[model samples]
Target: MSPLVIAGASRGVGLELARLARSGGRPVVALVRPGSDSSELRHLGVEVVAGDALSRADADRLFGSLPAGCDAVSTLSGLAGDGRRADDEGNINLVDAAAASGLTGRFLLITSIGCGEMAPYRSERAIAAFGAAVDAKTRAEEHLRGSGLAWTILRPGGLRTAPATGNGILSADPEMHGFINRADVAQLALRALRDPSTRDQAFAVVDRAEARSVNAIDPHPLLALGA
Candidate 1:
């Protein structure tokens, strides 16, 4: 099997993805930031590469230096402050690097639900803090949609650290709001890497039971909206 390259795999969903991939006997190359703690990944025997994903040259170096023919790529990068430039630039750089790699494999991105026009800000401070990140994710999604690669955009809603229940819901429209466990999200991404039916689809994920119930709530109305 070809190696899987996971950008921002130092922690959270990225780290979980690496662990799962490694346990499944798949080679994993984890991209970490300089000085970022990677003891967890190291403990899992994952190969670690250090670089910032927001820079094209750095991203190129990270991916280029890897062994050829990676089977899949996942970007789990996130933002912490009110810096639109950093978020937008990082996403764009990652997309560009993925496009340049010329690897005919699954390209999966961990984006958030309500990333574009649907992103809700309940307060001015919150809006200011996350506005840039939302725009950046939106742009990144758009780029991936048109990048001509076999892509699957997994947009998760209200990520939590709870245990996984092996169930989740996927909504195509943004009106549905719910929470999802990060572990479940990681599992979904891993599954999509090899699942042919998930290709070329951008889905908003939540707890599966919630999704089914939402689908049952005026199914025709929801279908019409998505249509």
Candidate 2:
């Protein structure tokens, strides 16, 4: 199995993805900003590379050194109150570097709902608070869509810190909206990586039980658990 390179692996879904990869016996490399705590990643035996995804030099250096068959995933997002966001340029750097690295494997990007064609379904409050982030992520998604890499984009709804409920699911429907735990999101992403049918498609992730409004949710065959 080829190693998986995960940017923004210091925490959140990125960290969880690294954990899942390691548990499945896949070698993993985590790119985290310098000075961010990475004790857990190291504990999982993931190679922790200090680099900012926002830096082209850093992205280039990390991806350029990886073997050709390596896969990549970016859960990079912007921080509140910061003018500089890894959500846009940072992810762009990753996509460009991966394309240049001869990465023959999949590149999964974890963007949020309300991006691209799903913009209208987003809540007004969310748009007001995270409008900039959403816009940035939208640009990142566009870049990856045209980057020519085997790509899968997952747009997750409101995130929760609770443990995995094993209820999260993928829906091609743009109207799906709800909350999903980080662990479940990580699990769904890994499943997508292993299933070729999900390539080049963007899915909205949500826990159906928690969904406030959901319809026409056609779960991919590989991801449907009937939960």
Candidate 3:
């Protein structure tokens, strides 16, 4: 099997994705920041690479080390608090790195809900504080859309670390709101990588039960247009 490069595989959804990829017997190059602890990833039989995804040189080194035709690349990089520019720079670098490496088969990006939209003040504030991050993600999505690659952008709702219930709702529009487990989101991300049906589209993920019960119209067509 081809190696899978997982950026930001230190914890949360990125960690779970690395775990799943390793469990499936795929070689994994787990990317983590310099000086970051990666004992967990190391324990999972992954090759750890210390580099910031925001740096072109680091991204180049990481991807260049991989075989020309690797299986997939998934990014779970995000910034908390007010460092949006840093986050965006990092994500954009990763996207550019992936493109430069010619690894375009399956690109999975984990973004958040309420990204790139103007709603109430509360929502706007929430977005503006991390506006740089959201804007970066939106642009990253746009780049991937035009990159002529098979990609899947997963915009998950409020991420929680609760135990997995093995179910969640997937919406293309942010009109519906809810929360989803980080583990569940990881599962969905891996699914998107392997499932061709999810190609070239952006979808929001929530608890599956909630998705089924929601009254919002499907946003698949709209998402397809962006593809």
Candidate 4:
């Protein structure tokens, strides 16, 4: 695999994904915000580029050097009160800029389960709490889907800060909902990126148990989780 360009690699699932890629002997170009510490990434030999995912100029600068048809994954998001637009503006900038760069391969996007058609399955309270973020994610998904780039959108259930259980699972059943470890999410992103069958598809993911790794529990490497 060529160097994978990951947006939102400063921390959390994005960071873990970068680690996995590096561990697998794949080069990583991690995009993070300016001023954000990249010590962890640098420690892993990742090439960290500081840029706001919501800035067109920044996005252009990052993607301009990316090779055409290289894999990219974005997990950009803002917290509840950070006053930053993440799910929407953040991802849109990366998507649009990458598309324009003509170097984007299969782009995998990570979003929450309540986004898009899965909204109805969420409780009213949950929706009310995350409604704004969900709305923004939906719009970003729409833009990516319509951007004419090969893309796969993953709407994972609640994310947890636990260690990998490897029991992560994926389903097209929008009604299916649960929580997953950030590491499991990263594993799924790796599988999906290499699977051509997942192109232009979207699905919900969650962990069924805390005993196995996502890839280990579901070993069919070519998009068999939700098949």
Number of the top candidate by TM-score? 2
lDDT of 3: 0.70
- The list of candidate 4 runs beyond 4 A from truth reads 79-84, 210-227
**lDDT per residue (tens digit) for residues 1-227 in model 2:** 78999998889999888988899899999998888999999999999999998889999999988998888999999763457788998999999999988888999999998898889887889899889999999999999999999999999999987788888888888887888999999989888888888999998898868765556656666644223
Please write out the lDDT profile of model 4 over residues 15-65, one tens digit for every residue: 989888898889999888878989999999999888887778998899898
Error of 4 at 24 (Å): 0.4
Against the true structure, candidate 4 has what lDDT?
A: 0.82
lDDT of 1 by residue, 56-128 (tens): 7888887676554675455555664554343456766766777787757878887776675456522365457
Candidate 3: residue pairs that collide: 168-207, 168-208, 169-207, 169-208
Candidate RMSDs in Å, in order, are 5.5, 2.4, 4.9, 4.4
Estimate every model's Cα lDDT from 0 to 1.
Answer: 0.70, 0.88, 0.70, 0.82
lDDT (10s digit) by residue, model 3, range 30-72: 8788888999999999999999776689988887887766755
Better of 2 and 4 by TM-score: 2
